[model samples]
Every structure is written in structure tokens, then in C-alpha cells.
Target: MKIREHLSLLAVLCSMAMVVLDAGMLNVALPTLSNALAVGPADIIWSVSAYQMALLVGLLPSAQLAERFGHRRMFVAGLMIYLAASVLCSVSPNLLALLVGRVFQGLGGAVIMALGIAILRVVLGPDRLGKAIGWNALVVALSSAAAPALAAAILAAGSWQWLFLAKLPIGIVALAASIGFPPSNSTRSSIDGVAIVIHAASAVLILFAFERLNSQPAMATVALVGVAGLARWMIAREKMRQVPLWPVDLLANRPLRTAVYASVACFTAQSAGLVALPLLLQLGLGTSVIDTAIVMMFWPVAVAVTAPIAGRLSERADPSILCSIGGMLLGAGLLIACFSPASAGLSPYVAAAVVSGAGFGLFQVPNNRTMFLSAPPDRAAAAGGMQGSARLSGQTFGTLLVGLLLGYYPTTDAVSLAVGLGGLSALVASMVSFSNLPRFVQRHHA
Candidate 1:
């Protein structure tokens, strides 16, 4: 890669890191924001939900839009929006303002997330794609794991507003680096207004249903039904169109669809473990926040160390086999964590974290390579969108699953149960991954 390409990669990584960091950091700062903004806990949840909903709804559309316009233009526009929204969030005096700002931030983030992979596909040749994706995964894992600690440090130094303020410098640097990239040639396509409405409605309704499941079960059920109906309509509508916004044809590929399902399962397990372990450590075992953070640090650190190697290995090995091995390791780690006694020290927990992280890191890059490679070059943006959506949906499902388990087993060790379920999900993912091996091997042989 040339210096310019390296700088462009850096810019993309910076933008990706900022978004991931923001997602994780806000969770840590929610309590502080609630108190500072004089909002009730329930209402404060919207601050996060609004952002997530916007991102989910915008992802596919943004990808299509990127194709219609240009990746470089969309990326720069996204950065500008994100930077502006960050400043708005920092200066907001009330909850509503912050929520609105977060929504815009999420819209910007959707563009960045959707196009980052597509841009990489364009810039990097096929041989180097897996390695680049592996490095990208490393950045995501590292940013997510480091965010809480970074947020804490920032809060200790100043106000919560500084958290948003900190994003400005990174955004500026990313924008500058991104400006040198050549523009993508725009494709001519008529925008599908009805399809856009259907897609957005389905995404928002489904996400809202998930968000309300534990709180307002009745409303959630209704929303779920509405989502199902909208999704059916959307699919039927898209099936008739030659150039559908949803790209149903790409998903029709058996191997790609299987890879997507496996990705979701893996992320679901990972997210459940992440959410449950903190609760187990802090509330159940009476570990301090700092101590919990310290122990948890091992997971992302391990992922960062493992992913690049896994990426390189994918070039020479069957990704499906690698995914299976990684899933098994993740399952084993989660199973070990489930057996964590309340009186036990942190070493056991740390070991489990490291194992799980390493497994996830190994699984991610190869799986992504499989998904990206499966799609036709013309549908790269759609593939990227689908990949991003699968991750976010799986994470949302996992988080909610933990909450549901906790609620259902109020008298039991909910944390252990959730972790156990996560292990089961990982095992299922492993099986699915293994099932893909024959097809992968056949492809290679052919």
C-alpha cells in the first residue's frame, strides 16, 4: 500500500474507532448524564435508544445512497454530521437536545459503518482484504473494551461533556485524511421511496419492540407483530424490483446467508457474556468497578492480539474451520465463567475472559471475509450493510436476552444462567460454522 492508501486506512480506522468508542462510552456515562440533565432513569434510556434506532433504520438506505452518490462524499458528509452532533451533544442543556443530537450522530455513524468495509474492498485487493478486515475488527474490539475505562478517566478529569468534546480532534484528523481519497463514480438509480419507508418502519418497529420487551410487554408484542407484517411486505415488494434497495438477492446466496446467521449467533453469545459478566462481578461477587474493569480488560486485549493473526491465517486456511474452532473456544470460556463461584478470586474470571475474547477475535475476520467475498462486487455496499445490521441486531438480542433471564429467574443466579445460555449459543454457532466447512472445502477444491 502507498502512503496515501495507508493514510486513508488510518482515517477510516479513526472514524470507526470513534463510533465504537462513543457507543461503549455512553453506556458508562448514562448515569452521570441522567443526574446532570435532571432526567428520570426510564426517560434517559431514550438517549441511547434514539441513537440506535436511527442507526438501524439508516444503515441499508445509507449504503444504497452511497452507491447512488459516492462513498467518499458520503463518508465525509457522515464525519461532518457526527462532528457537529458531538458538539451539540456536549453543549445540550436538556435531555431532548441530547437525544436529538445523538440521533444525528447515529445517522452519521450508520454511513461510516456501512461504507467503511465497502471502501476497504475498493482500496485493498482480494489477497489483502482479510488482513485489513482483521485489523479493523481489532480496532473495534479494542475501542469497545477500552471505552469504559477511557470514559471514567475523562469524567475524572472533567465533566461528562468532555467526552463528546474529545471526539472533535479525531473527527478532524479523519476528515483531513479522507479528503485525499479519490471519489467513487456514482451509479444512476431511481430512489425507491416506498421501499425506504417500509425498510425504515420495519427496522424501527422491530428495534422498538425489543427495547420495550422488558418494560411494556403489551406494546412490545404489538410492535413485534407490526414489524413482522412490515418485513413481509418489504420482502415481497423488493422481490419484484430488479435493483432493490434491500438487496434480497445477495442474501439469497446460501453460503452468505449461513455466514450471516453464524455471525449473529457468535455476536449474540459474545454480547450476552459481556453484559452478564459485569453484573456477576460487581453485584453478585461484590467486586469494585475498577476491579471489574481491570479484569474485563483482558478480553478486548486478547482480541486485539489475536485478530490480525487470524486474518492472515484465513488466507491460507478454511475460514469455516477457523470459525468453528473459535466458537468452541468461546463456548468453553463461557462455560467456565458459568462455574465461577461467588467467593472465587479474579484469576478464574480473567482466564475465561481471555479465552472468550481470543475465540471471538479469531472467528470475526474470517467470517467477515466469507460474507464480503460471497457477495457480487456490485453489491458490496449491501453486504457491508447486512453485516453491520447483523452485528447490531445480535447485540441487541443478547442484551435483551440477559435482561429477560434476569427477570425470569429473580431468585436464582441470573448471571450464571445467562452466561450458560451464551455458551449454548456459541456451541450452536460452532455447529453452524462446521456445517459450512464442506461447502468451503468444495469451493477451494473447485
Candidate 2:
């Protein structure tokens, strides 16, 4: 790659690492935040949930905003908001204050995350984009791997506030880097603001319903109703639009449709493993917080090692087979963990992690390559929005599945349920994988 391309990748890596680290990093700090603010466990959960919701709902709008205004401007502005929010979070005196700060952090995070892949598409050709995405995957895995240790050290040395404080300078550096890189794609006409609002509203309602389904069933019902109503509105609005928020024609396109479905399924299984395994270790099996984090490390470690290899292999053969094989392995790993429950020693859980992680690592890169490249160049930003939204939506759905299982079965049965769901999702994803084989071959020739 050229120096500009290398620099672009570096900037993408740096910004993405900062954002993804925050995903798991906060889980480690939850106990500290709860104690410091004297907040209930329920309220504290919002810290994480709020961030995820903002990212999910704000994604398409961020893409549209980036296009209407400027990618460079939006990126820099997002960094500023992230930095300010981090500072606010560090000094937050009450639960409400912290939650408010987190909302902004999530919004800013949405902007950065949504644009990263879109920006990469502009700088790198299709062949190189896979490597770029591989590196992006590396940053994600590294962040997940590093967040726990980093948060633990901060909590030990200072307090929970330091977690937020630490992210501030890094955000500033990313903002400066945004200045060096010029926007790659030219801007389009004004995006349909009504479509943006309709989608965002529906997403917020759906996610809120999913997240609250276990604790507040009544509220979940209300949220789900809103979700249904808004979804209807979104569909109606899209039918009338010249260009919808989620492109209708793109969804109808055979390759794009299957790829999106695969993205959702693959991520659903991946998210379930990430969320459930740690809970199984710490809450279900009675392990130390640090030890739980240590066990969780295996997943990202495997992903980091495997993604580049997957990227390399994609150059030689069909990505569909790689994806199908990966999905099957993931299902197999989940099944292994389900049947073999973790004892207090953590060995069983570690073994489970290794299997599940390998499956996830195998699936991610090739699948992402297929999704991004499936769309045309002009739609890259929208494709990025779809990619981010699908992953978040899948994670949201995965969390809901786990919650529904826990509601029926006891907490101890959580891992087994997670394993069952993982296996089922993989099976469906594999079917979709078969459909993709010829597409990959055709695209190779094209």
C-alpha cells in the first residue's frame, strides 16, 4: 500500500480501537460506577445500553450527516463531542448526569464507527479493502482484549472516573488526525431527513423494548408497540422516497440481501457468546471479576490471530466456503460449551472460549468483505451504515434471546441456552452461505 493508504489505515485503526475498547471496558467498571454514584443496578445498566442505543439509532443519520455536511467535518465534530462527553463522565456527580454524558458519547461513537468503513472504501480498492477491514477487525479484537486489563488497572490505581478520563486525550488525537486526511467521496444532495427520523425512532423503540424485556415487561410491551408503529411508518415513508434510508433496491438485490441476512446472523451468534460467557463465569459459576475478564480475553485473542489469515485466504478462493465453514465451527463450539458446563475452576469455560472464539474469528472477515463489496461504490457510506446497524441490531437481538431464555430457565441454564441459540443461528447462516458461493465466484470474475 502507498504511504497515504498506510496512514489512512493507521488513523482508522486508532479511532476504531478507541471506540471498540469502550464496548467491553465499561463492564469492568460497572461495579465502581454503581458504588460511586450510589445507583441501583438497574440504572447503572443504562451506561452501556445507552451507548449502544445511540450507536444503533444514530448510525444512518450520521452517514447522511456526513454526506450532507462533510465526512471530515463530521468526524472531527464527533471527536469533539466524544472528548467533551468523556470529560463530563469523569466528573459526573449523579447517575442522571452520567447517563446524560453517556448519551452524547454514544452519539459521537456512532458517527465515528459508521464512517470508518465508508472512509476506507474511498481510500482503498476492493482488493485492498478486505485487508483494510481485516485491520479494522484487528482493532476491534484488540480493543475487546485490552479493555478489561486497562479498566482493571485504572480502577485499582484511581477510581472509575479514570476510565472516562483516559479516553479524553485519545479522542483529541483522533480529531487531529482527521484533519490530515481529506474526504474521499464528493457529497450528494440533501438526504431525506424524514426518512432518517423514521428509522432512528423505530430503532430506538425496538432496542429499548429488547433491552428492557426481562426487567420491565410492561415497558417492553409499550416500547414494542412503538417499534411496530414506527416500523410501519418507516416502510411507508421508504415506499414514497426517491432514495430510502435503507435502500429498497439494494435490499432487493440478491447478493446484498443474503449478505445482510448473513451479517445479522453471524453477528447474533458472535454477540451471544461475548455477552453470555462472561456472565456465566462471573455470575453463574462464581469467579472473580478479573478472572472473568481473563477468560473473556480468549475470544478476542483468537479473532485477532485468525482475521488476517482469513483475509489472505479470501484472495485465493470463495469467501462463501470460508464463511460457511466458520459458521459451522461457531455452532460446534457453542454446542460443545452447552453440553459441558463450566465448573468453578474456569477450565471448562476457557475451553468453550477457545472453540467459540475460533468460530467467530473465522466468520467475521470474509463475511464483512462480502457485505461491503456487494454494494456499489456510491453506496459505501450507506453500506457502512447498514453494516454498523446490522451488527448492533444483531447484538440487541442476541441480548433479547438470552434474556428470554433466562426468564424461562434459571440463571444457571444461561450458557446452555446461549449454546443452543448459537448453534441454531449458525445453521441458518450456513444455509445463506450456500447461496453466496456462486456470487463470490461471479464477482471474482467481474
Instruction: Return the TM-score for each candidate structure.
Output: 0.97, 0.92
CA deviation > 4 Å runs, candidate 2: 184-188, 215-219, 281-292, 341-348, 439-446
Q: Against the hidden true structure, what lDDT does model 2 obtain? A: 0.77
Error of 2 at 124 (Å): 1.8
User: lDDT of all predictions, in order shown?
Assistant: 0.88, 0.77
lDDT (C-alpha) at residue 349 in model 2? 69
lDDT of 1 by residue, 273-354 (tens): 9999888888777899989988889999989999999999999998889999999989999988889786678888999999
Local error of candidate 1 at 351, Å?
A: 1.2
Candidate 1 local distance difference test against the native: 0.88
User: What tens digits encode model 2's per-residue C-alpha lDDT throughout 1-446?
Assistant: 67667666676677888887776778878988898999888889989888887788788888777767767677777777877888888889998888888899999888888778777777787877777777888778888888888888888898788888887666666666665566644466677877877777887788777877888999999998888887777777676765467666467667667767987897888777777776767666688987887877887888888888887776666778888888887777766666665453777667767767776777777877777787777666667778788788777777777878878887868666886787779767767876878766787789
